[model samples]
Target: MNKIADYIQTAKLESDKPFCAFLYDLDHLRAHVQARVDSMPANTRYFYAIKANSELPILRALAPIVHGFEVASIGEVRKVRSVSQDTPIIFGGPGKSDEELIGALEHNVSLIHVESMHELRRLNELCAKRDTVMPILLRVNLRGPLPTATLAMGGRPTQFGIDEMQIAEAIQLAKSLPHVKLEGFHLHSLSNNLNAAEHVKLVKYYIERIKGWAAEHDLELSYLNAGGGIGVNYADLEDQFDWDLFVGGLQPMLEANLPENMTVLFECGRYNTASCGYYAVEVLDIKENHGKTYAIIRGGTQHFRLPVSWQHNHPFVVVPSERWEYGFERKGVEDQQLTVVGQLCTPKDVLASDVTVPNLRIGDVILFLYAGAYGWSISHHDFLSHPHPDHIYLGGDDHV
Candidate 1:
């Protein structure tokens, strides 16, 4: 297992990762998974959510290891089908068309997560007409902080889930429909400050809620679906999440509350695959303004582009031929502020503001750190005039 430290060391020595590099530290990511899977009780399942980072290598790495795949669109559904036929498939996202629903049904996937009453009702009607029992998971509107915290994303008005007020009525509808099986409930809080421990807290909370609700409605609950917001901190490598501590914190709770025969399902998309991609591009020129210097790279927001996301700046690194003795400055000197801007026509094309690198030169390539998640896929403009950077998948048993 290559620790983050080992990856960094090897990268510094290899000398080949110069043009552009994302440096997917999946070795660390998989170590996190291995630690958790080892501790999790039987029947607990993890599903690699496809939206976060859907590169083929990332999918291939996760497919053989995870219990199933969770898809939000027919395109994602097709991606899963291309990989493994036996991999349990779960479909999600709102506004799925009738054709999409029909396709999902045709695939005989494990479950479909529905967001609205209209969708639920429509899916029920379709299942009845087809004379097939469609397995369904109810997405709840959990807002704010989840359990173990006062605020809630597992608690109201969350657009992704059905409103809390609608739960009982939906259940009644399910009981009478005779076609949709209410397998379990699902919740997803965006990437935030939670590790395996907080995730387990959510699971335990759901178990109690599901059990209590099952008793009230005289229903049998056989599944528990937990939302995926697994977070990966790329800026501070040492701040890497401790998956063992996380799994240790939740394993006992899950073992205690999970109903017998219930399959615990996890939807993890980003954290699972984000570490495996690398985006590389060469520097086109360098410009000097006042006392500051800037390196204009061939790729900008039009290519491997990511600026501030979720209100945080993305990680990036400038590759220098010689090892520098002085540390890289996080902020520029009072008179030396080199703002890196993308080549796009819009002013919003700025990539970083007031960033100081290794006194960048014309031919130096600036490598964006942890760019595997979006890189060329999210940044390229179909309408732009700039040439697109080529995407590559460096093969390794360990995710690329």
Candidate 2:
């Protein structure tokens, strides 16, 4: 049996309540991230976005491999610092408070992605107060004929970054500010972009645009922050982001159009960590309601909210368990389509919908795949005050 199945079986033997836990394969994570880092072209860097999974074990595993970390809040910055104090950190988010800005500055963050004109000024003012000159990347909301992505933070009216048309003005402001140094532009417009060719095309577009802007403004820039949106195929695990294809296309583009001494940075969250994590919950009950069958699990959206949040049937496997402690007829459904739900009162507590499962019993564990990123970290854990699932890490230097 695979590690997930093996772990589930072991947990069933140990626990009588229900097996609900997040199992992270550190060996798999390290191998996957190392492959991605090794495959990147010259002058290219990969920064793991901590918003995906901020667990300490995950951070420690990735610290040596990734070039740096991309954080959204001060809390994330502190988390990275606790793991590796010397690792470079780039802060980026909307509605950043004064304390967050101060924290970023005091913590010696390598870069801060300025979202707006007011934010730029605010950061500049904060830097002046500290008597420190800070390097900043002006995040631009490009006006583009861009490719379709799962989520768009730019190329539209969103509370993300400065408008492309107003970028020139923002650059001028940054230059005039005494305490802030303009590094480059951050064009992280898309989220969950699956097409490798289209992503390479987007990178080319970013390079050309930035080159034009540098010439026009006479701006000496070093970093080009291309936000990470490489997507995961939740529907089909077999179909995934072609990293080799992307690198094949990207290497030539960077070598041809990239400016001299410019280091292109990719801050990827989901793509790096999603595959190495699994959310396994034991089945509490199995029954047919009206015409459809419902296999209720011990956990729900509160534990793993990716399916309901994305409105897609997350991929999973039913780990069969032989142990049945109840003194009654064992409930099960064989070769039938079922909707997996959690033990929540609301109807929205769904994990997988309209999925066909063969031989799913009441005691069997449902292991949801591709759950490393944005699973437990983004969930409402306090909802209904249910007991939180145990976090189990497997096969790493530090296995806790």
Candidate 3:
């Protein structure tokens, strides 16, 4: 199959609009997800986190492969349900309204991860009103010396989960609640932790802690939801998480140590989808300022904002172009650092800075790879009234 970026570049050449688009390769997505699924050991399940890329076609393409989905809001619940009827759904977030709780109960979601004692009580009351039992996993803010990560939430006091000091109290409260069943704990501590061994170690810590709690409370937990923070190498495009090494380390450890009755679930978002998407934008102008080359593109952070959020030089390739119409000498620089900026008026709209690339000119396309996950969804599309780039789907004949 053609590289996703190359395919997108061909499509961009055929289009008349300002050359920019978010292209998703369904074939690549399917293969990537399937490989991850296949690598996982038995008793472990995979759930696609819909917050990564909630596009209808992306959801539909992934529904059949994943066991279920992890949604943060009621709208996501509905969206997942629209694509899948039988697949299980798990709801988790810092804040959830009474209406959302009721809706989740009505939909019979597989599990609602309780973020705090208050949320636990709220869910209990909501379940009581419906006269139905609600299954839940306590989202714990593990007070820890966790593995170093790009973003760490578990070891600190964050809005994500219950404090580690209160687990015993939370367990007693769970016992008192009649409608809510605390089946296990959700330990989602880090974001983008790349080390496979470190991830395995984190999971081991979660199991030991949860097992100790279950034994102390004399409770038989069903599952431990390790909130997914699987990393993607955004800084180096060729580098990726060593899934083989991860699985190799994880399986043996689980086989020897993990409790036989408990199952593990990984609700991965970015790692599952990032590799399949590409964002391509055409250079509208090229100029030199203060000994620095700047290539301004038609679109900026409004359409692709992950680079700015991560503050990394997002990897890209220069789709070299020879199309030049100007009678005057064209501006071109070779083997020099190029700072890529979007059309947004603000200076903070830079996508990449001080990156060495081939000479660039007006009409040359810069295709940003690995933009499938948080590229468009987290962007400020309406910030400056810039036209949204076409969201094109590759691998299938459909164009959006």
Please identify model 1 stretches exceeding 4 Å from their true place: 1-39, 143-156, 289-293, 321-337, 396-400
Please identify model 2 stretches exceeding 4 Å from their true place.
397-400
- Writing each residue's lDDT as its tens digit, candidate 3 over 1-400 gives 2575466556656765668888888999999999888878998999999899998889988998998999999999989889877789999998999988988977769999999899999889878887888999999999888998899888876788999999999999998999998889899999898899889998999889998998899988989999899999887766778889899999988887788788999999999999899888989888889988899998999999999999998988877656565698877778888899998888899999998886677787888889999999899999879898888887666677
Using all chains and alpha carbons, the TM-scores for the candidates as numbered come to: 0.83, 0.98, 0.97
Candidate 2's error at 364, in angstroms? Answer: 0.6
| CA lDDT scores, all candidates in order | 0.65, 0.92, 0.87
| Candidate 2 per-residue C-alpha lDDT over 87-126 given as tens digits, one digit per residue, 9 for 90 to 100 | 9999999999999999998899999999999998999899
Q: Rank the candidates by TM-score, best first.
A: 2, 3, 1
Give the Cα-based TM-score of candidate 3 against the true structure.
0.97
Sort by lDDT, best first: 2, 3, 1
What lDDT does candidate 3 reach at residue 369?
85
Question: What TM-score does model 2 achieve against the real structure?
Answer: 0.98
lDDT against true structure, model 2? 0.92
Each prediction's RMSD over C-alphas, in Å, is 5.4, 1.1, 1.5
Candidate 2: clashing residue pairs, number: 0
TM-score between candidate 1 and the true structure: 0.83
